[model samples]
Target: MKKIIVLLLFFITTVTKSQNELGSWNIINVNMKIDSKINVFTEAQLRSLSFYNQFHYYEFKAGVSYKINPNFSVTSGIGSYNTYSEGGDFELPMKNKEIRSWFQINMKNPLQFITFEHRYRAEQRFTSNGYRNRFRYRIGATMPLNGKKIVPKSFYLSVWDELFFTDKEPYFERNRLFVGGGYEFNKKIAFQMGYIYQFDYKINDESGRDFLNIALLYNFDLTKKEEKEFTPATTD
Candidate 1:
């Protein structure tokens, strides 16, 4: 894909920069609550069909990230989902497995009261309905309200907005917006939650689709450190 190639080139360029950009690796767990309504036109025109047997999904993902430094990181992930319906779905298909990858850059001092990060994600979805790919990018900022005041820098909070696109090759389009929060526990673990909203697909008397998600994250440094340890003296 064109987007994939662009990201790979950008990563190579960043690595060639003089400054060292690396810290550690992180592991995260993600859970998603998703609902979708699909319509299949009996006729090929696709305008003569009624929506039926909406699909619902509960997805769980395992993600791993490689930090290039304090400013950037790339993550890879995979997800498995559970389908909630089996009726009126003979013609339509649903989600099966997905591939997730993303690149993120942080633009702020680690000690600053606030920090911002840009994240780009691409997904390969193989569902019963069809195989589709999607791209999403997020603008996020972290506020260290308590991290600045607490010893050992143990706590922080963050908020983010995700903008997504689907079917960009044949016809470009926007998908949804995600608003979310992150809460840190100690230095190695964190919690996150969010709501997702789909736009411009409105129908009278129906609320738009939304998701309530929760995630657990574990992050730490992995850079090689110089050896410097003071040994205790032995008395003869």
Candidate 2:
């Protein structure tokens, strides 16, 4: 059929132009609760172009979150990124930086055997080149491997797919697919390691990259108790 021919040609062209590269992404995230409805978080990341070396970039972010219910939450965050050349070159004309602000909404759904999270995000970016805006959506699912729930001391499987879009001519930006597993150390900390496949589209070419993803997550609660005023005793 005509459609089959077009599909075959597309696959052939993609395979011929594909340049596979390996990279690593490391993340640390901490969340602190201010009250039942409010929370804050900080995150940092180190990215590399090689297995464990050849530094690529670093990012820092801070954010506040508000919980609407058990299943829904909203967050606003600001981030700074410093990026170098592919081989860790930081010389002039090879380095760039960006500042970005984002807002996101997250929702959770419980299924029979798997739990799913839906995230919608919008970003305002100020890059070395200019300003841009993007929107993203991701759907993630987790299933317990050794227990009924993803509780402490349990391992779970995690998978997600995300897509990015812009408002320009080529509205489609990028896509990411991830598969990984996490082990909950306790109620407050956890670790996840996985692999990510990223596909990016440009004006005339497309590229594919593979990444090793590593993450550490920390959670704590410090909700304020009832407010009270203290009266000092007056001497007579």
Candidate 3:
């Protein structure tokens, strides 16, 4: 459809645009399973309950930052990170709702930074016929190359491998991979995104497994601390 083409171009532009100052993630993705058995978690979760099929999915996630140090911080809050069914009759194919949380440990070097990041999630999975309960975990790293140490204008890149854990009462265990990153505008704002290329699995819509992810973080100063401003000396 025309809309799909527009969206594709939107993602392409979003990724290449360096001036995007949004303090959140805005990732665009185009995938084709890259592998078979596409949605591992969905298949396991809905193995016994039949209502969905193979299809594609798209998602978006945004959050705020809590700076612990120049190189360290904790991100908390909410964002839109969940799984929806492929082309179907029902409007509510929202089988998974991701409650986002992450802890990032950074190592600041001379011209760049290395981060060992862990993303934890509590997901609400829905069955084709009824409702179900499930959870997923993602652990990865983001490596960023800072343009300037004092006033960072742009960032290079980062990537990571993920191991997804799930207990499918209906099926078996499944795994996946998540790779992505973004550029920082300041300590309070940023723009970035990622993609999830899935492996061996099955679902009503396999496309749902291959998704685009966007992340934005905003830091609000809760505690106010006043600092003395510099005063110019005058001749007596």
Candidate 4:
């Protein structure tokens, strides 16, 4: 009986020491089309810990994308991020800010029931500490649950996996997996809510900061209206 009691105590202690917190990430994104082949996108995010009590970070990003064709596009972006330290018994909030510039390429394939997308991005980061570079790749798929496409009044499922790599110490940075459901209000507006699981190599010991991710997206088209084709004057 005593041996079993000791083992139980050890197990409980290990679990308590490794406990992690859950967080929330909320974002708003907008995309505007400049023409048939070009677009601009903007995003803002609020990230929090402890169910929105403890503020964690804020991020703003803007980018331009050029569609090479229906299936492929390239993007370049710049972002500013401010991160705060988690508050605790003796800890105080301090801000660490970073600026990042990135470029990405994306490819898409459409199937009967699902669409698959692949993205590759490279980033150059500037921070108070120093400069760093990182690379990331993500594979994602979306399927409509109620309609043929993610059209108005349609519900959809989205799933993705992303890997992060860096040139700094611990070359492997992190990995993320997300599963979500979204509703398309129209071609211009949509909302998604999901859960994201992230594995961080820098933070050892399964820091289970799995997050609730929420996003509101808006899309706009700015393409110039096509002019009517020139008509030849009819000769009487």
Candidate 5:
């Protein structure tokens, strides 16, 4: 784990040194497990057009997820998304104000050395321009560097590609590709850093942008634990 982390840090540092400038995508995520099958989560994001400069977008959302089995799950969420004009920190004359709701399904498959994930989402957007519907699909893979499973104190590498679609004339809206590494601090906390490239199909302001993505994730267990063990009576 230590070696993997060192390598990942070196790679990121090299890329950052090579680039002139890159945008920043920061996220904080909190998840609570209500039981074995139910979970709730909240997330907030802040994004800048330059390295911590020209802050342009922010969002906050909350959601609930249900696990149908080991491989499949469903989630629903609602959020307020706001985008600012790109001159300074949250510049006036907001470019877009949106209230969005989405429903998504996730599927997971574990292989000998890697795990693959598939996500499909449908979104309803109430934006300043008008109301619209959008769809998205993402495929991702993760591999543990030191062990077969990504348990606590583990390091893993992940890559994903996501495509976005809308019901408009052009149909395709955006595409995003991400490559990153993560370190699990314990069963409940983790940190991830990565690079992402986003391309907009003539639809958004943030087209052809490269971002340094940083995220902190936390999980909490809310289930009750039994303190006593069951014992059987012996007849003498």
Candidate 6:
């Protein structure tokens, strides 16, 4: 399709522009459906200023999600986040060591082959510097390239923009924009890679950076053995 080709070209162009300064952002996510309305999930991230080198940041988190309806869900999570100096691989004298807890809400609207998603989150951060409160919102859309829905062997495209703010003066904090695509290998596994541009206001540790984002997602259903319709995992 003409639209698909245009999108692909845009993706390639953007990545090419930032290739020289691109950082690495990698994630692993696992989700398990424990009941009809409850799910448990865990995620980990590792990041570097270069392609697998100059490692600087990492985080691990686990949470529970409750589906309130077909269109809405709520989640709560806690995580350990660490950031190191940028010169070496996780160098000494970490810049920031943080324990973060967050509450989030998600809403979805599906139209034909595309789904529009909205996410809102509030975070309580306990960091080496001090305690802080932050809020974020993201709007995203996903479209299946090969089928009406994301199923086994399907390919999909996703794009999102997120804004972050804090409670103090100069409240506007950061912005993140992501564009990427993924392939569904089966009902349980999928892999995604994309480009992300992040901009921070007056933040010194993790400021403006272009990242190559890669993620692996796994989903499991514990209640039944029968195969069901696949639901693609969403990332932040």
Compose the digit string of candidate 5's lDDT tens values, residues 1-236.
56757476637742764544688889988887787889888999999988889999999998899989977999999999999887899998888899999999989897988889899999999999789899999998988777887777777787889999988878998998888878777777888778877888878635367888888888777776431211110000
Give the alpha carbon lDDT tens digit for every residue of 1-236 in model 2: 53344345334422343456567778888887788788888889887766677766788999898989977999899988777766553323446678999999989897767888889999998888678888999998887666667777767777789998988868998998877667777767888767777888872211346777778888776764532211010000
Flag the better candidate by lDDT, 2 or 5. 5
Q: Which is the winner by TM-score between candidate 5 and candidate 6? A: 6
Weakest 10 consecutive residues of candidate 4 by summed lDDT: 227-236
User: Estimated TM-score per prediction?
Assistant: 0.49, 0.82, 0.45, 0.82, 0.89, 0.93
**Which stretches in model 1 have alpha-carbon errors above 4 Å?**
1-55, 83-111, 149-155, 168-183, 192-214, 219-236
Tens digits of per-residue lDDT for model 6, 11-83: 6835686235778899999998898789999999999987789999999999999999978999999999999
TM-score of 5: 0.89
lDDT of 3 by residue, 1-236 (tens): 43344345446633453432211223332111111212001111111011233322334433333445443434333333445543442235566554433332323233235445444444444434344343445545545444322123444244544444446543423456545545556544455555444443443323323434454433222233321110010000
TM-score of 1: 0.49
Residue 65, model 3: lDDT of 39
Which regions in candidate 3 have their CA more than 4 angstroms from the true location? 1-85, 88-112, 120-131, 147-151, 169-174, 203-209, 224-236
lDDT of each: 0.39, 0.71, 0.37, 0.70, 0.78, 0.85
Residue 48 C-alpha lDDT in model 2: 72
Model 6 alpha-carbon drift over 4 Å, by segment: 1-14, 18-20, 225-228
lDDT of 4: 0.70
- What is every candidate's alpha-carbon RMSD to the true fold? 18.9, 12.6, 15.4, 13.1, 8.5, 2.3
TM-score, structure 3 vs. true: 0.45
- Candidate 4 lDDT, 74-184, residue by residue in tens: 999998877766673212444456899999998989898888988999998887557878899999898877766767776777788889898778998889887766767
Q: Which is better, 5 or 6, measured by lDDT?
A: 6
Clashes of each: 9, 0, 28, 0, 0, 0
Stretches of candidate 4 off by over 4 Å are 1-19, 88-95, 203-208, 224-236
